[model samples]
Target chain A: MRILEIENLKKSYTTPDGEILTVIDVPGFALESGEQIALSGESGSGKTTFLNLVAGILRPDGGRIFLGGEDVTALSEAARDRLRADKIGYIFQTFNLLQGYTALENVLLGMMFGKGADKGFALGLLERVGLGDRAGYKPSQLSVGQQQRVALARALANRPALVLADEPTGNLDPGTAGKAVSLIKEMCAESGAALLLVSHDDKVLGNFGGVKDLGEINRAPRGGIEK
Target chain B: MNRENVGGIFLIAKKSLAQHRLSTVITVLSVALAAGLVMAVFSIRDQTYDAFTGGPAGFDAVLGARGSQLQLVLNTVFHLETSPGNIPWEMYEAIKENPNVELAVPYAVGDNYRGYRIVGTERSLFTDLEYRKGRKLTLAEGELFNPEKREAVVGSYVADKTGLKAGSKFNPFHGLVFDERQKHAEEYTVTGVLEPTNSPSDRVIWIPIDEFYRISGHVLRGGGGTYEPRAGEEIPDRYKEVSAVMLKLRNPQAGFLLDQTINRQGTAATLAWPIGRVMAELFGKIGWVNNVLSLVAYLVVLVAAGSILASIYNTMNERRREFAILRALGARRGTVFAAIILESASIAAIGAALGYAVYALILAGAAVVIRAETGVVLDVLKPGPALLAAPLAMIALGILAGVIPALKAYSTDVASNLAPLS
Candidate 1:
């Protein structure tokens, strides 16, 4: 079953001078559980833009985002938030863990926010990522690799069916990027979640099952994968 | 929302606040200091009024050779100024003998000990008084004045200062001057030391009217009196003149009727209703200042609240992404709004409480200075409406402060905030 679907989506920004600049135009796409896709393009390719639209973090000018068969684009901001928390998990390029909370506490923050009843599950996810010993340390105390693990733990804390990662390993060392990607893939496989990874790094392309150029599509009419 | 659920937002707020330690401390301390000032002022008002009325049932009214209402209140109610007339003891006797009168205590006050006046009245002045709390005046130590003996009952404050306990003797200077010839040349034993009432009564040395008279009359008759222990005189013949007479009416409404009756009868003294006079003169005269003070207090509180809002609003610029993250994690918009309000409310509450406590400490510390200077006891704890007035103002301030932050949090655009932090 298709866990996510998108129709023709459009997004624009109004400059301070009142000029409307079209940022993205994307045709429909769908992804089923356990499928990993790499969205690749040059800089300003709108890979992250498409992910934002699918994750319900940005409202497209015109489109429909169907997540788990629910039209999230038609929902209110609060309802969209609910949709995001329940079905969409996002991993930022920079692991934005709240600076004050400990790593385990940050993981718990996601679960505490979600409808999940098992708070300890956040800790278990950290253990699964092999950073259980660093749970008490804050983000500043953790290395880039450890912080990414904590971010991933938080991402999977709600067991969302779809995971959207924007340059997940872009900031990591080449050796650490390989480990982070493997861990994310392993965790997504274990959970049977559809993973949409947006990155321009050539090293990431061959690791995924499918690949597409967002630069070709994002600048095309309605920005579809097939220009 | 369930409190358990609300706990999550609070946890976030708490963590965020903890992260910004210097900011949080500054905010809390600023709030606390403001609140402390408000609270202290109110506490002083309470403590002052508390010691004044001593729970309200203490004295009825002052019957003096009334000139001005404020002056009469100052003299009789507060024992600060000297009453004008002698009011012949016969008039006090008449009121005491009246069937309608409950108790008529005559008072003669003029001499001072280190600036605190000595209030000479009949022993009934202390004994016949009943407080609202059902507590009677008992000597903290020693016996009440021996009626026939030339003895005095010193208030706790007076005893505290002079270190004169029961059975200790002290001679009175004939005048208010510090170094003056002793009048009537007799030592009066302190038979009792009254409990500290924290009122004007606390500062007074309560000697018998006869003792006050003997000293005053001797100064008049002998021309130059010294502490020469006069010939064995059981009760000095010169103990008749007094300063003023205090009349207690049988009914409160009867105050006017009694005043009419007393003044019309051409009595030696004048009649005054203390409560009526206090209401008319005290507030009437200072009402504008009080109103201005209230306005200033409100403006100050408003400014404090504005600063709080400004601080939160300023922080919100940096916190937008954080809120978006929270919302993405399933925190409701209301949760975000409430967290901001909670932070402001905490500051306000802490500030109010601290301000009140500071106000109390000031009053308590300055109690003696106030009593000695103005003869008005400042209640550092049991304040009047001013105490209540302060927190209500702060709460209003809290609400005002919370509004801006809450609205900012509510209007936070999650979509733009979380805009693909690439």
Candidate 2:
């Protein structure tokens, strides 16, 4: 069963030069339930744009994005936000945790817009990510690796059907990146959430079950800016 | 939003504000100072009006030699001004015998005991003059002044200031000036000390009218050469005069008839109602001053609202990433918008509350000094509707200040913000 799918997706942007630049033109894409895939791409290859499109943060100019059999592309911006909140989890390379919130609070924030956001479940997720002792620490107080782990815990808090990791270990050292990637994969597998891990690093790609290059999936021309 | 969700939003806003401690404190304190100033102005205006208009003496009319009615009331009733000339003893006799008059207390004001007014009147003044609506003057020590003796009854303020107990002797001055050259040769012993009434009379010394007439420089119309009645010398009725007659009417409606009759008949004295003409003129002259002060106070609050706007608006640029993160985390645009508004409103609410607290403290401190100086009691605990409404208005201004920043937060580009990470 497909957990995420996009068909004939198209997105474009107008530059300061008043030229319409197409950033993403993907003919077809799909992720099976509980499947893990590495989306490999060089710089400026629309990998983040693809993730943003699937996460419902940005609307495609023309496309059909189906998340759990619902055509999210057809929904209003507000409805798409609700769908993203209810079904999809996103992990940014920067670990985008609110600096003011404690590690536990960051995880709770993910479940804030969803129903049944229990503190016990949030604590359990923190403990599962090996940060239960550091739950009271703010993002500024945690190490990069520790912050990434907290982010992974937060992403899985709402029991999302699909998790998009956009270079989740990009800012870490090699050793820390390896450890963070392993923890992310383990957490995604345990939660039974499909993973689309976007990265340019070959070492990050080796851990995934399947791999696809964004250059092949995205049909936009190579010379244009991909944002 | 449900109650639980609203609670969550507030929790997030509270934590966010805590993160930016310095900016938050500065913003809130600025608002507090403005609110405190506005509240203080209003409180003082209310207390001043109450003190001046609702004085202890409930006289229906003050009759004095033809002059400013306000000055006549000030000199004779409030002891705030010098005598506006004097009315004859025959005029006082006529007023005392009038059918419409319930009580007529004569006042002869010229002398002062070290800056406090010395009013001369008969024993009837202490017995018949109502201090605060049927409340008569009660002595704190000794008896009322004897009409035949050259004695004085000191008010509470005079007793406190001059340390003049019942047995203390003090020479009266020729006029309000307290120079030794102006002091009379004959001394009047203090016979009584009146209790504190928290009125203008609290700051006066009362003496027998005859002793007031015999002061060395006081001239009698029919005779000269220090008109002092030596022991058994007769002082002609035509030689005597009193400064004013404070009348209490049997029926309050009679005050209007007497006031009109006195002015229309061109009598030697003019009748002035203290609460009506005197207070009306006073408030009319000072009402614009209050209006200007209130305008200034409101402008301060407006500047406070501007500070709130600047504080929040200045932070919107840095907070875009934070808002984008919230957006991607499943928070709706409206939720983020509402959260920003709630944050501003919370700051305003806290500031307004602190402002009122500061205002109360100031009033508490000022009340002691005001009571000592003017005998006006300021009650800080009594909150009027404007007290509550002021803070509510501040919160509304907070919400108004938040609109622009909330819109900026709502329209933040989530993809652009997250693209930095990519």
User: Candidate 1: lDDT of B120?
Assistant: 76
User: What lDDT score is found at residue B82 in candidate 2?
Assistant: 78
Q: DockQ of each model against the real complex?
A: 0.42, 0.56
Model 1 lDDT tens row, A1-227: 88988788887766667766666777767788778888887655567667877877678899888888999889987787667777777888877777888988787777665655365787789899998888899999999999999999988988989998889898899888988998999999998888989888888776887988776556543322211
Q: Give all TM-scores, in the order shown.
A: 0.88, 0.92
How much DockQ does model 2 earn?
0.56
Model 2 chain B lDDT-worst window of ten: B222-231
Clashing pairs in 2: none
**Fnat of model 1, as a fraction:** 0.33
The most accurate candidate by lDDT is 2
Q: RMSD, each candidate, Å?
A: 4.1, 2.8
Q: Candidate 2, which segments miss by more than 4 Å at Cα?
A: A224-227, B139-143, B147-153, B157-174, B177-181, B184-195, B214-216, B220-226, B229-237, B361-374
lDDT tens digits, residue span B1-422, model 1: 65534677777778866766676677666665666565654455445444443423355566666465456666766666656655555556767787767778877766655555666777776677653346666789998886556788987878887898998987776544455544335678989998876555776778776566555344322112322223344443333445666666677766766767765775555666654445355655665764575466566666777767776777888888888777766677887888888877776776776766666666667776786755556555453675677776776687678888788887887656764433
Model 1 stretches astray by more than 4 angstroms: A14-21, A216-227, B1-5, B46-57, B126-136, B177-185, B216-239, B264-268, B274-276, B328-332, B366-368, B372-389, B412-422
